[model samples]
Target: MSKNTLINILFLGSILFIMKLTIFPQESLGIGSDSGGINLVPFRTSGYIFLHETFIKFIINILGNIILFLPFGLFLTMRFKKINRLWKCIVFGSIFSISIEIVQLSIPNRWTDVDDVILNTLGTAIGYAIYKIIDKKKMYLQED
Candidate 1:
């Protein structure tokens, strides 16, 4: 009913979504690319390994990485007026991605990738852009 209540709900939803993306089983989902050459195989692998994995899988992986952080940027900017800056959301996304990668290093069967960080940052930027656009539209409409 209140703005704070909505913010809290969004915050919880964001955290749950993030956990779903980052948490993986100790056993390998075997999503790795064995064919090699240019695939979305984590950090060191070549893009050739793309064939080992399906095109749809690759697309989902990339898009999933992006969408995973979208709410983070949106909800963060919405909840914290002070952190509503575009740069701040970008930084937060970067840090969050890096943190996931680092934590993955300690986890079994998880490989950290630079691509995730880049994709996540892009997602955060996009979310912030959406927020800004909507925010501007709201202000414009309110001018009446």
Candidate 2:
């Protein structure tokens, strides 16, 4: 990524981080009434599916979590190209999630849950994975 791209990503990431901190404050903190509890089932089975409820909720939840920190991953990746490795991604994601959890714990309306950290890390990994796939594809195309 170029300097301009790095700057853009940082600027956008900051904006997104702030927006996330405010807009879905409750959900982000894993405290909202609608923030549903964590299900032990790895994947929802057919029996668990409700007629009115779409499986898309699972997808939406996963995607929303992944998307929430995408800008963070994108910006970090762009800014520190040298450390653009999986371990670094994991560390950054972990730290970010930890920070959020800590903040949530201190906030009045927020409820910090270890589960949220796990979910957030999973989300960060997903975002980083997406970024890697796209970045690699772009590089391959350019090489070709």
Candidate 3:
């Protein structure tokens, strides 16, 4: 297959992975009673960062959210050239995260955390930074 086809597969796969993790985690594990909610304030998840836990668990819970969205920004920018702009990427990332949260509101066993949105945005920003860095290098090499 072509490069664009491969990238589209990656993008679509990522979205499915995200939805499964965020919305269907409990049921995926054979558990029930999945109600969801919304958090208005930011940085609420920071408390988890300090909680005493195994290093792996701590990193997975706190850092996983950020890492989860990193590929989102990259793959999205790669697919949609118009989102190459940093602000556009950020706005799009925020909208995507918020829409997920909103959907969770009506679903069972899901959460709509503002902190997730914030950290997910951070991941997108970092991914965008990488994209810009690589793109700049490409321009520099072309000029040489």
Candidate 4:
């Protein structure tokens, strides 16, 4: 298959994986049933998790949110050159993350938190940065 085609397949798969990870029930993931609440205040959930929760929980709740969206940003940047700007990546990431949070509001055991949105956006930014570095390196190599 062609490179762009392969990237498209990977991007679709990544999106599905993200849906399964975020939208599905948590029992299979071993987290048990979440209380199902909304946290609007930025850093509130993250701070609590950092200070009171187990290290694993902190990682899962904090870092996990960011890591979850990294591939999304990378794929988005790779697939659509129009999203070349960092601000575009941030906007797209925030919208996607916010959409997920909105979906979680209806799910039985999910917690909708602003912190997730923040971290996910950060992850997207990081992913875009990585893409730029990789693209630059490729350009440099071609010029050599």
Give the number of the best model, judged by lDDT. 4
CA lDDT of each candidate?
0.73, 0.61, 0.77, 0.87
How far off is residue 110 in model 3, in Å? 1.8
Candidate achieving higher lDDT, 3 or 4:
4
Residue 117 deviation, candidate 1, in Å?
Answer: 0.9
TM-score of each: 0.80, 0.63, 0.80, 0.94
Residues 2-56 of candidate 4: C-alpha lDDT, one tens digit per residue: 9999889877876887888888876856542757789999999888988998989
Model 3 TM: 0.80
Q: What is the lDDT of residue 97 in candidate 1?
A: 80
Top candidate, metric TM-score: 4
**CA lDDT, candidate 1, residue 131:** 86
| Clashing pairs counted in every model | 13, 0, 3, 0
Candidate 3 all-Cα RMSD: 3.0
Per-residue lDDT over 1-144 for candidate 3, one digit per residue giving the tens place of the 0 to 100 score? 999999899878777777776666555443235455567777555565556556775566667888888888888888888886889999988898888888777777667789888888888777788878888899999999
Those runs of model 1 whose alpha carbons end farther than 4 Å from true positions after fitting are 26-52
After superposition, the stretches of candidate 3 with alpha carbons farther than 4 Å from their true spots are: 26-36, 52-56, 139-144
TM for candidate 1 is 0.80
